[model samples]
Target: MGRKEFYWYYKLHATTAIFPTRSDGKLSKYKHLGKAGSQTYIDAIEQITARTRIEALDRSIEALRQGLKDLVEETSKYNKE
Candidate 1:
């Protein structure tokens, strides 16, 4: 059997992403996923906070549908006037 290893991605500052090397200043072999403001990073965090990606996506889709429905109703009411 083999074990999977994980590394920590700490944002030293708000601008860039860097692998914090040790006192020897050596970067680890871990791959960088994505930057903070990028869509990948946002989705990853959302999935972590929510039960699952499907649930998070469902919530967003439902909100959009409701907003569209409201806009249609408002437009129809205005047209009726």
Candidate 2:
């Protein structure tokens, strides 16, 4: 997908979280991480990383399949002659 499409996709499905506020009523810098830290943040990071790796593997598999298909066609043509 293009940048704009991916941006909208995430924007539509993104989760919302409320963080603790400061004395002045400003939002915390570590909004997602939370005050004392959170397992959710770690899990989210891991999940995203795993998804990226899976996508890379899927692309690699498709490329390999295409290469093998091309090689088979070439070999068949050579044998016919």
Candidate 3:
């Protein structure tokens, strides 16, 4: 198994309900049936990374939204006074 095969298997599993991902993020037993088991433990750090990027992005978006809201409210108050 190689990086290419693992990616292919990953894509295949994502498309179909055949091979399931385990709680540990590894492929299920059925994955070996396709002969991709050899690359199960391998990872691809070049093209992808699984970390807190999504969480950080969400927090940034929320902060921006709240800041915009606060600005709008303060401007409206100043206009009235």
Among these predicted structures, which one has the highest lDDT? 1
Question: What is candidate 1's lDDT per residue for 1-81, written digit by digit as tens?
Answer: 776876445232323334545576665544244567667567656755776767889999999999999999999999999
Pairs in clash, predicted candidate 3: none
**Local lDDT at 61 for model 3:** 100
Give the lDDT of residue 76 in candidate 3: 100
lDDT of 2 by residue, 16-45 (tens): 433445566654434343322356556656
**Tens-digit lDDT track of model 3 for 3-55:** 65433343322344445565666555344323334344243222234536667
* Candidate 2 minimal-lDDT segment of 10 residues: 5-14
Backbone clashes for every candidate come to: 0, 0, 0
TM-score of 1: 0.37
Better of 1 and 2 by TM-score: 2
Model 3, C-alpha of 5: deviation from truth (Å): 30
- The TM-score of predicted model 2 comes to 0.55
C-alpha local distance difference test of each model: 0.66, 0.63, 0.56
CA error at residue 41 for candidate 2, angstroms:
1.2
Better of 2 and 3 by lDDT: 2
Backbone clash total, candidate 3: 0
Which of 1 and 3 is the better model by TM-score? 3
Cα shift from native, residue 47, model 2 (Å): 0.2
